[model samples]
Target: MLQNKSMIVKLLALLTIPVSHATGQVPIDPNPFWQSGEAGVYSTGMIWRDCNNDGYIDVFFSNGNDMALASNTIYISQYGSLLGTASWYSANAEYSGHCGVGDIDDDGFPDFAVANYLGTGGFSTAGLSNLYFNSNGLPNTTPDWYTGDSIYSFSCALGDVDGDGDLDLAFTTGEGYTTKKQRDLIYFNVNGALQTVPGWQSTMFTEGMDVTWGDVDNDGDLDLAFCYDDVAAAV
Candidate 1:
């Protein structure tokens, strides 16, 4: 049926999934360096975890204040490498875009989520779709939780979905190009909290964007996948 190029690079390396949540790679330095950290490049999305756990690997920059007024940044590690940025989270004008991490409230640290792409050509960039709670270790700048979107949210994801081990958040909205109708949210996390409308919503999807969870069908719970960047508008 399909050709074979090393089985399609081993099924694309088992579907290469690593968007960062515990972070890694800042260690192996033998002259391998890569810089580019002035932070706030009008970012639209960013998430890398390890926020303050310190073992290294950190970075969080999610901004989009209408082109230039950038905010939201936290680049830790100092003696381990990231060296600079730390402090400044969603400073204002609104537009966050797509952001995510985990832990959610399991408390052992790790937490981050933000997707607020509130309309553009249709007007309405109010933006507000967040959930940041790492508290004492630094990650809480108010938003113990916030969710409300229908105009457009790019994508934000956290896991567990329904296994009951905690951590569940998945939001995606797109269709701001106009025609309307587009939804995709799934909060769900009960006992550990994170419910305030959205146990599931899907208007058949439009410009959705990112969003990913596992458990394909071995069927134990978690299962979700959304990808759409539609810019055309007409369904």
Candidate 2:
């Protein structure tokens, strides 16, 4: 009876053991540094930079949903550890989508932009975007500027398209169940501020999803490429 009991106990222990450990294979840790615990609910956009000028790379992520009963938050990292949340400049808008970082004000420090895909009510069509300037590599709660009215922004990109030595802004806009065909836009940097380039808005294709600047044709000047979400045949 004692021998039979020992055999049953050993079988139970072996069943509890994981297959990887039993097979002598080491399991890899996905979140080895505990960075994922800091991610807030509905976290979408993430970017890495020296946000505090500490020479160590930091991370930033936009938590958009209201799942935690809290407002939209931007979580920052401090040398591989989750530091804290940054004060969002726009209190009323929900930033649960794409984000980009660049120096929009010709400052030495980099600035960041967040896109408000869904508005406060969670299905609002009046989406918005905000540009927060950096003060000595730290984000300023007060935004340097914001988008105009009736603009439903989705994604943003920063580049010197005109090659004038200052960073410019390009963004995509559209929403669900809307008849208005979405298009991309470019705001040229002029004297540390963004100005909508004349006739630029009319050149975008339908259903603009994202925009980026590059010299695709090997030209000296940078060209803009807009990606669309739908396929349209040339009729």
Candidate 3:
């Protein structure tokens, strides 16, 4: 215990060491530059990519607050440091923190599929997850397409689930506030748009917090995995 205390003291001393600041550059600390919204109070998730094609990676954060009218925000990068000249794009969303990015429009620029709910109602806020097509190096103000689903969406995965040479979407949802219709869904990519497969049946008909595509079975094809929020135990 004495040796452990000495090691901890040394670590603390190292952390307190003063870092020299470069001209006009922000010094990084042990704390992550990525911070949640509302001064680190409400946060859901975020993505880092070059949204404007300026060669500098930008950032997008989903609002974890369900009651806040503005639920999404984007920050453009300036290529200097993490903190530099950039701007924000804010929009109305409902607890929209989960998101996926891809070039759905085949425009060589990545687009977004952020998990969002439609309408202002607090009950079962799942109406349509947004599909923001890349427009002039930024996400379009209006979504190019929607999944057209009414089920509550917790998160989504965007990839080529069908090996169709393009990206597809997998939407997941969890039961919210005694909501009855919670299910996971997959939409096939067809000519830059998405469509539901005919006669396709879903085994994950219950609650799903997240979804992804992988070859867990190693059958030479991608498989979808539905992730439910639960406590994990490590052995």
Candidate 4:
């Protein structure tokens, strides 16, 4: 059966050559702020959490430099369906950098926090970067400027560092200057206003790219784990 052996060899060879076929799975393009693959558009950040407890990753997408169309567009989706989509702050403006999430107001529900770069399409224009407190699950109202605001919000984390049962927020901002020049702004909730928490600050990080919070140290106090891109070599 020489002919049969040749046919089997041919089939084996065909199988060896990597065949590429589409998975027929359409990826959910949930980021409404930036069109797919458009230049000068930033899409996602380091902050990703299971907001709906669905066991699926809820990805939040935003813009970096292109503020005109990027502002006010944050989409949250899982299972290929968009569960939440809202534009909160800096309407029709460009939002840059990263965002955070946790129950800052201590309602046992997670709240949302974002760090706006406060610049133009490039780093030329500078304005006040903002932090919005989402009291309810998602925004039911329009995203006007809130009462407590911060400028140059590069990154943020949510935790009750003081062990007060009420979760607080820790955010960082500033230029890529000295280590001390970079600052940590701790917002403690008191009577609905985010008052400052004192003495907990140190030279935690420089040029903080993203901030995450959890009980990493196992000390029962919620700790901060920040990704610092600029000083990775130093660490």
Candidate number of the best TM-score? 3
Tell me the tens digit of each residue's lDDT in model 3 across 147-173: 665656667778787777888887766
Off by over 4 Å in 1: 1-36, 44-57, 63-74, 79-96, 103-152, 155-163, 177-180, 187-200, 203-235
> 1-235 in candidate 4: lDDT tens per residue?
0111111000001123343456643333333432222233454344455544455544444456323325434344546344333323334455555666665555544555556655553444434444454555453333323324334455666667777666666766544533323555666665444563433554654565566677866879777666554665221
- Between candidates 2 and 3, name the one with more favorable TM-score: 3
User: What's the distance in Å from true for residue 102, model 2?
Assistant: 0.9
What TM-score, over all chains together, does every model reach?
0.32, 0.71, 0.73, 0.58
Ten contiguous residues with the weakest lDDT in model 1: 4-13
**CA lDDT scores, all candidates in order:** 0.62, 0.57, 0.59, 0.48
CA lDDT for candidate 1: 0.62
- Model 4 residue 55 lDDT score: 56
Name the better of 2 and 4 by TM-score: 2
The RMSD of every model to the true structure, in order and in angstroms, is 19.1, 12.1, 9.4, 13.3
Q: Candidates ranked by TM-score, best first? A: 3, 2, 4, 1
lDDT of 1 by residue, 160-219 (tens): 866778888887776445534467778788877888788888767577667777778776
Error of 4 at 129 (Å): 3.4
Residue 135 error, candidate 3, Å: 2.8
| Residue 14, candidate 1: alpha-carbon lDDT | 22
lDDT of 4 at 223: 70
lDDT of 4 at 213: 72
Candidate 2 lDDT over residue span 23-49, tens digit each: 774444333333244333455556767
